[model samples]
Target: MGAMDVVLVHGIFDNGAVFRRLADALADAGHRCWVPALKPADGRTGIEDLVAKLHAYIDRHLGSDAEVALVGFRMGCIVSRYYLQMRDGVRRTKALNVATGPDPEVGDAPKPTLSTSGC
Candidate 1:
């Protein structure tokens, strides 16, 4: 299969700069990648702010037809979910990787139908 576009979201104490090597590797592999910094006050800022920034960056950098895979490290996972749920942007996103964090229990929570096909 062809490579999918991806956006890297950083966690606390970082600003997407940490994903530089990963981004470069992805780019070199022919997949479009972006590492936009979404700074918060070291967990002081709300997730909404970060989510909004994520949406803005995607809208401005990626076109409307772009479908990307979101890879989040630590708190960035929370930010990714908010953007996917609140903005209903899941349809435009291919996958979400919630790494370096605890996995959430979305089975009981009210959200979109997440199945193994996309898993």
Candidate 2:
């Protein structure tokens, strides 16, 4: 595919700096990458709050109409999922790449089906 707008999300206990190398590589490859540092990385503020912050970040930086590819690591995967499933993100998300650890929120839950054919 051509150059895409990509958002890289860091895990709990980490910040956007963690994706510096990956962002550099993606940028060098002509992709527009945004690595946002979600505050309260410890997650004491809750995942929904983090998702809200992510939503605002995307709105501010990428606009609501831009199609984006999401890359999430560890706890960020969970945040990304919430954004996709509950925040209308599937409408504008071109792809999702999740590198996640064990997630209690997903354990034993039915898998969600996301339609991206029109994205």
Candidate 3:
């Protein structure tokens, strides 16, 4: 497949730097990658705020009509979900890959998995 746009969202207490390796690999594979640092990574600012930031970032950098695949880690999964489900992001999202972390309900995190749904 031709190069596709991919946005990597880091986990809590982390920044875009955390995706350096993955971004490099994706770049080598001919995919365009964008790792945006969501501030207040601790989530004190709330997921909705982060989602809004994510939406604005995508719109500014990739444009509102561009299609993208989202890779979210830890708390980023929550933010991504909000963006996709609550913000009408599913319309432009090509895929959703999640790297889960500790969960209060599950008691333990599940293995990392990539979940994708057609837009």
Instruction: Provide backbone clash counts, one per model.
Output: 0, 0, 0
Local error of candidate 1 at 35, Å? 0.8
Q: Which 10-residue window of candidate 3 scores lowest in summed lDDT?
A: 104-113
Answer with 1 or 3, whichever has the higher TM-score.
3
Q: What is the lDDT of residue 43 in candidate 2?
A: 96
Q: Please write out the lDDT profile of model 3 over residues 10-89, one tens digit for every residue.
A: 89999998899999999999899998889989999888889999999999999999999998899888788778877788
Per TM-score, the best of the predicted structures is: 2
What is the TM-score ranking, best to worst? 2, 3, 1
Model 2 — TM-score against the truth? 0.88
User: lDDT of each prediction vs. the true structure?
Assistant: 0.75, 0.83, 0.82
* lDDT digits (tens) for residues 4-97 of candidate 1: 7788888877887878898898888888888888876276777778888889999899976688888878877777777788867687888777
What clash pairs does model 3 have?
none
- Model 1, TM vs. native: 0.82
* Number of the predicted model whose lDDT against the real structure is largest: 2
Quote each prediction's TM-score: 0.82, 0.88, 0.85
Least accurate stretch of 10 residues (summed lDDT) in model 1? 110-119
What's the lDDT for residue 50 in model 3?
95
